[model samples]
Target: MVANDPITGQGANGAAKAAAVHLESILAHGDRPFDRDFQQAVADRVREGARPVVQWTSAMLEPAPEHLLGLLVAAAELPSAADRFANGFDAAADFGQWFPDPEGAADHLASLAPRG
Candidate 1:
């Protein structure tokens, strides 16, 4: 069964994505038999889509680094930054652009600073 950590707070989101994958796969298969191969292919597709989300969720489980904490604080005061972070929940892959390391996080925060 396809399942994910509920601690990630993505159970509903993941289920929705899985349902879409299943429906798309079924439609694309046309009259093909629902055999083990087809099921495996669908599972693989789901895993591919979910990989980034899982990575982000796993990261969240770890203790936050100072830079990450800074981002959180900035997010509270910056509406745009907060929105981007909120959007990341739906587009978890976006987290990869800036959420993984100190350098990326710093760069992202800098970008969010108001240009003079």
Candidate 2:
């Protein structure tokens, strides 16, 4: 929020743009404004006399992906089949076998439920 002012000779023009960059990037989860770590990084950049890009993130508790990706990788996360498949067909060998969509787990659960 108004971290620098190049016009006023008080802050960096690029810093504002940088801030905007932080705001605009696409997000998954835990990548929003007022996030402790994210906020701290931006503030540190500003404090270091860096430029801002004027970006907006998805949520308050979330963090930037570039920063978060490392943490995710460190956690040894794996992509699911749903993530790999583009559509229903890539999931199975043929129609005879259930090519359950990786993302269709919830649907499978529903199907298994006893219907009246």
Candidate 3:
């Protein structure tokens, strides 16, 4: 499969790893992998589908909220519709907002932040 663009110059996998790592950091010692409550909440936030890691990063970056990794994990789990919304939001907002749906977000992110 063709590789996606590098988001933040980190490359696709790197971006994914970064997102995961960041989530781990945000989650901190309370739960190395994130608490079930947090995890479930994240799952709900995500639109509803599988998505690339960087796109997830983009979603988490929204609000530029602190301790973003765990939030990113949740964002990653967003639905296709929600991801798309966020991506479109970001593109229209000059990359300011998350995609409204996950698939759209993933596709949008792939276009903007492809792997090198």
**lDDT score for residue 93 of model 3:** 37
Ten contiguous residues with the weakest lDDT in model 1: 1-10
Backbone steric clashes in candidate 1, count: 0
Stretches of candidate 3 exceeding 4 Å from the true structure: 1-18, 25-34, 42-93, 96-116
- Candidate 3 C-alpha error for residue 23, in Å: 3.2
Candidate 2 wrongly placed segments (more than 4 Å): 1-12, 24-34, 49-116
Give the per-residue lDDT of model 2 (tens digit) for 19-98: 66565432432545566776667666444433211211111134434423332342343333233222222211221122
lDDT of 2: 0.36
Expressed as tens digits, the lDDT of each residue in 1-115 for candidate 1 is 3566777788789889989999999999999799999999999989887877888888878898898898899899999899999998798888888988899999999999999
Best by lDDT: 1
Please, what is the whole-model Cα lDDT of each candidate in the order they appear?
Answer: 0.88, 0.36, 0.45
Taking the candidates one at a time, how many backbone clashes does each contain? 0, 30, 38
Indicate whether candidate 1 or candidate 3 has the larger lDDT. Answer: 1
Give a tens-digit lDDT track for model 3, residues 1-116: 22334444435444454455447646664635677876565554332212344464465446654334333454576464346445532233323343345454445555544368
RMSD of each: 1.5, 18.7, 16.2
Which wins on TM-score, candidate 1 or candidate 3?
1
